[model samples]
Target chain A: MADIVTTANLQEPDAFYADLVAAHDGLSKDESDAYNARLILLMANQIGDHVILKKLLQEAQRTSRKA
Target chain B: MTKLFEAPLYPYKRCADQGAGKPVRHPVIVIGAGPVGLAMAIDLAQADIPVVVLDDNEKVSTGSRAICFSKRTLEILDRLGCGDEMVRKGVVWNAGRVFFGDRQVYDFNLLPEEGHKRPAFINLQQYYCELYLVERIRALQVAGKPVELRGGNKVVGLERRDDHTALTVRTMEGDYDLEADWLIACDGAGSPARRMLGLEFQGRVFEDNFLIADVIMKADFPTERWFWFDPPFNRDQSALLHKQPDGVWRIDLQLGWHIDKEEEKKPENVIPRLKQMLGEGVDFDLEWVSVYSFQCCRMEKFRHGRVIFAGDSAHQVSPFGARGANSGFQDVDNLGWKLKLILSGKAPETLIESYDFERERAADENILQSTRSTDFITPKSEISRIFRDAVLDLSEHHAFARPMVNSGRLSVPATYDGSPLNGPDASGLPARTRPGSPPVDAPINGTWLLDAMGHDFMLLGLGIEVPPLTELLGLPVKGITLSGEEIGPDLRTRYLGEAGEAVYLIRPDQHVAARWRKLDWTEITGALSVALGREGEI
Candidate 1:
């Protein structure tokens, strides 16, 4: 029997990242940045934690500005 | 004296026949306890309107018929205080896959737009959704804001009197007469209420038949929907495989054009077909198998006198795009607020006519789109087959194949253009920033209109000045004032990109009813009166 996985099982950051990469057929450098941005948003939506989502968005903006 | 009628499933214990006892009256009486009817009751009750829901069925149906809820539906449910619970139980599907024969033709992801609170789609059984809603209704009933549910109490006859509708309901134990200000029919396709009204249900009915088999499988299938054209097992037939919650899977197989309905029900012939499509080694037991004929039809009119139709009672669409239930929910969403407005005496009687016009148009559009999708998915004639094959063949080599292969338009939101309630488009706004496009959140110069609020008439203006617009019109308005410093880069970009103005008025159903860079009382009041169906407005 195939393993029965729930959303809870897929909630881990590592697992979520792995699934994202797999879904898009691996991540290039440019794709990785976009993927990270999308990942933060998806996590924020699922978690319903707007504070974390806002903080992550701010951090990404800061990093982009610095670069 | 003996009771006139009685039934075990009747939620109420009263046993009295029509003309045998005193009459009972309610503000609104709804038929069917399905998702649509329940949604209507919830909306009306929340607005402090008294309602009574009647269903022939004794209990909630066990199986999941429609499992997909769009983001708009979620917003409506959210207003009823059950959106979070639904989101928690349901699986969010952001991606979909299409298959041409055995080869994967196209795959697309539904990227969640910024500022939208809900995802593109959520998958949960309709039965569970109904159960959750019923529980909420029960709790409200316990708290004194009651919505009476009469299960197994079927409406035997309906009479629309001058001021009210008289319903003759029959339970196992007895019969009773009930009167209500308005009647809404949410019964299934074979709606007795709709039939009583003698409304014409006209549309195309496909000759092809399909067998739906629900199975408990242990195979490793992707969570995305899979459609196979001319699958390996049956070259002439098409098959669809979709994932459900738990270990369940739904498989739809075309049973060919010349299938004998009676013979197809036999398990002997059915098991072999199932095994052939699933392959030899797959171990899965079928829980249920049923055959269904596809039909695309809609009522000529959604409303007649005090009687209104919703859900399957209003229209029926092929299952190819899952448009039936989704469109039904949209109907309730459109009708709910209108009913609330009319019942509250905030709008004129003509406002109710808009509900009929808008929902009939919506149902027709849904049936048309669903028919087009079914034609694309399952081509009937030889010419259609050749065209379908050619399209798939072209998809393999062409760069534009992605859009051709993708069924994204199936899930697209219904656009409200040519609607009587709509206002003239302002010229200065960017072409893409028109109504029905994505909404942007900007600083509240007075009140802010957010797209996250789902379908509703929203007036956003500069603070106290906007109060006159609502006070005079008796309409709800939100005020927002934006300071230069408060606007962030991303927010500013979206606002400028989408709205192209500082202030705008949105419709109840989220189409831009009217918009202005600044509030003009003359234009605003005129638009309000037109939307409310008052004379000499615009």
Candidate 2:
């Protein structure tokens, strides 16, 4: 298990949310789901540590289920 | 005051042998007197073949167009005998800074670790490059080499016959008949030759306009590239500033798709834009201004019978990455040697087809890169703009996303990896200077390896002494020994590491045609024949 490190994260949270929403501007529900899957894989590759990535993935899945 | 280069018009001489009675056949006739045509003429003349050049305009380019000369372009120009002058007269730069709204995001140095000669990029006006080439041509002429320049001679009609290419050239005096063994069309993007032949220029046109201005001011701006995406002054638009020689700065501002062209180019409209960018009290003289749209297009094939197209005549790309002229120089570099070999009866005419194959690959690459840079610079949709800006923002803090910021992916030489001219790579060898790759510069004794070779087929011996009697199937091959002290350890690691006595058969354009672990005559001759289009699998 790994702890999530957060420092100076999302200073402009509104702008980041705007960008995140705008990324799926024209995509349908299926396409947006596919886009999110692909984005997760891309970010996983960037975050090469498997233990940390798995922890982050579990946290994200937990938070998303609550939402 | 800025120094401006004036193009000296060469006197048109009427050859008595080429009078109006009958058409006289020339060995080679290069259409257009721009960089590509002049470079081709110089290469042919240097190879001891007589060449004549024809151009409609009596001078160099009207303005400072195509300012970025890459290292590969400089290397090719060095072969043409005018590189030192261009380097001396140009401003060399390698570091580039990218900005997003006034704050600097990231910066990159192209050649951070350098041992070789020539910088990554040199910012010189195109007119000065042409002038240096013209001076070299004149020097070759003074030395009694046959290189004829016919300025104000426009090629109107072109007929590609099976035997040769016949041309109806239009001169100020009158129209004259001329024929050539090979006719090279370098008449630029709006090529009349390509249009006359009904060749289709096909590709994507970026729907954005750029206002390019050359302003002469003695400012203390460093010789580094500055690119901004949505700067404070420009406000949500991309802008680029590059320093050129003679106290001139090239400023490119993205002026979306729709705008009055004449209105955007006026001094009144242009001056306010300059004042906003360069602050107040900066007395600057406007050298030139032009509004241009981006297009990446090319002909289906570069070779058409005896008529071959080179440079912008064959392909055109956006000016973002400086691919338009640098790639044109590569075209000339690739074509010059092959054409000379064909004309001198050393190789078969089929060898010229490789030029079409290789240069089309290069053009496709340039078009792809320029299109990506253009797309990144001026994104089409709102989502794209969001991603681009986000990438820039992330690049400011994160090192991982820094590579996403594309401010004109600068030009580099294209390696012909899958070229038919390449032979199999030996086992346990480094892959930097492999077959189809350009020769990596290494100092041997006193002179550089590139300056030493390129006259003919050269057999470079690495890590071992070269043997004599180097006649490869009745073709003379010059053998040179490399001790690998010039480029230091990099050369040893790249060229010769445990591969005892490696031999490379280099082409006339200084590209590695084939390489072998041992000096085998049969393998050498087989690869050489394939390279010359003689026989075997190509």
Reference-based lDDT, each prediction: 0.68, 0.81
Stretches off by above 4 angstroms in model 2 are A1-45, A48-67, B1-7, B11-18, B205-208, B232-236, B484-487, B497-501
DockQ of 2: 0.08
Candidate 1: regions farther than 4 A off: A1-67, B1-20, B106-114, B205-208, B256-258, B397-399, B406-409, B430-457, B461-470, B481-495, B498-500
> What digit string (tens of lDDT, one per residue) describes model 2 on residues B1-538?
4334454456566655347599989988999899898998998898788999999877887678889998889999998998899999999887778888878888877664454567777899888988888889999999999998888788889888887888898876788889998889999988998988788887656556789899988567677788888887677678988998878899998887778989989999998988877778887888899988755788888888888899999998878788988998989988888887787777888988888878899888888898888788877776676667667766787776676778777888888888876765777666878888877776566667777776678888786566543776556788887654543565566677666557888887888888887778788888888888777543
After aligning candidate 1 to the native by TM-score, how far in Å is the CA of B506 from where it should be?
A: 2.9
TM for every model, in the order presented, reads 0.78, 0.87
Candidate 2 displacement at residue B335 in angstroms: 1.1
Query: How does the DockQ of candidate 1 come out?
Result: 0.01
Across B343-402, the per-residue lDDT of candidate 1 in tens digits comes to 889877677887777777777777667667667666767656655665665555554434
Q: What is the lDDT of residue B305 in candidate 1?
A: 79
Q: Report the error of model 2 at residue B22, Å.
A: 1.4
Model 2, residue B364: what's the lDDT? 88
Q: What CAPRI class is candidate 2?
A: incorrect
